[model samples]
Target: MKAEAERRGYQKKMEAEKEREKPKPLSEKILLQNDVIFACKDIARNSLNYPDSFEVENTNSGIDNQNGKQIYYFTLDYSGVNAFNVRGTHTIECYGTIGDLSHSVTHKIFN
Candidate 1:
């Protein structure tokens, strides 16, 4: 009976030690906010290389300035976010009637 009790105790101790040695998963929730700026200009006036009309449309991701010309500003409110999903560059997309264009911006949160 004493030998069986000692074996059970030793097994419990080993299980505890194993649990302590295991690495815990790394995860964290964070709040992300920033202003996304979209600069636009008339193609005819700005050397014929810019869009005639450009603006941001509201989507599931966030909100933006609805001015739709010259400059469009956006405020992001991504709260309770996961670290892994946001660990890279963020892309802000605005539609230009002439064609579709996208700008890639770096996120400082990773740094």
Candidate 2:
């Protein structure tokens, strides 16, 4: 009947609305690249109680630093990203400045 079809259409619209409200998660795996001049050790040595602004948050799996190994493990925070297509991958940025030197690094996280 016409009423049944209308009800079905209403239900479908509701389902579609729900789907639109819920965005598909970006990814589960994140890789962080060390774009600084020094390794973790050097960074730690230079920084002393400094404040870093990290734009993303995630769980860290581990660190990889070898040929073509440009990634670190981390969990993803969906609330961090406000825009899309910014970074081919999602990342958290940590920025710090000291005297004439400024350091910035990004960490990618997984789902």
Candidate 3:
């Protein structure tokens, strides 16, 4: 019985996911620090599982300081992302793939 219930739940989840992927007229503005702009319709889907991703290179000093990594990590609060309303702090406590690949900070975001 548990297995059957799980299957039904999985089906519903899949349908909901498909519904989300349906394209719609873009709306909503994402505000980020510095000169970079993050729009809701701009990012890509995370193939592993994350709905999307926002990468930043910390090259603040225009000219590379010879050995500086060239970019810095920032935070983004994207909790309010969805079909209805695209605005709110995200549930993201951190960023990156599975298994402690590497830890990094993030910049906040809005819908």
Put down candidate 2 lDDT per residue, 5-111, tens digits, no spaces: 99999999999999999977633232122323123323332232222322333323344554554334333332222234232223332322221122344432232
True-structure lDDT of candidate 2: 0.38
Question: Across residues 14-91, which tens digit of lDDT does each residue of candidate 1 receive?
Answer: 999999999886322111111222222121122222223222232223333345623222332112213343322222
Better of 2 and 3 by TM-score: 2
Ranking by lDDT: 2, 3, 1
CA displacement after TM-score superposition, residue 106 of candidate 2 (Å): 12
lDDT of 3 by residue, 17-75 (tens): 99999987532211122222232213322311235433332222121222433332333
Show the colliding residue pairs in model 1. none
TM-score leader: 2
lDDT of every model, 2 decimals = 0.33, 0.38, 0.35
What stretches of model 1 exceed 4 Å from their correct place?
A: 29-111
Q: Candidate 1: lDDT of 47?
A: 26
Better of 1 and 3 by TM-score: 1
Output the better candidate (1/2) by lDDT.
2
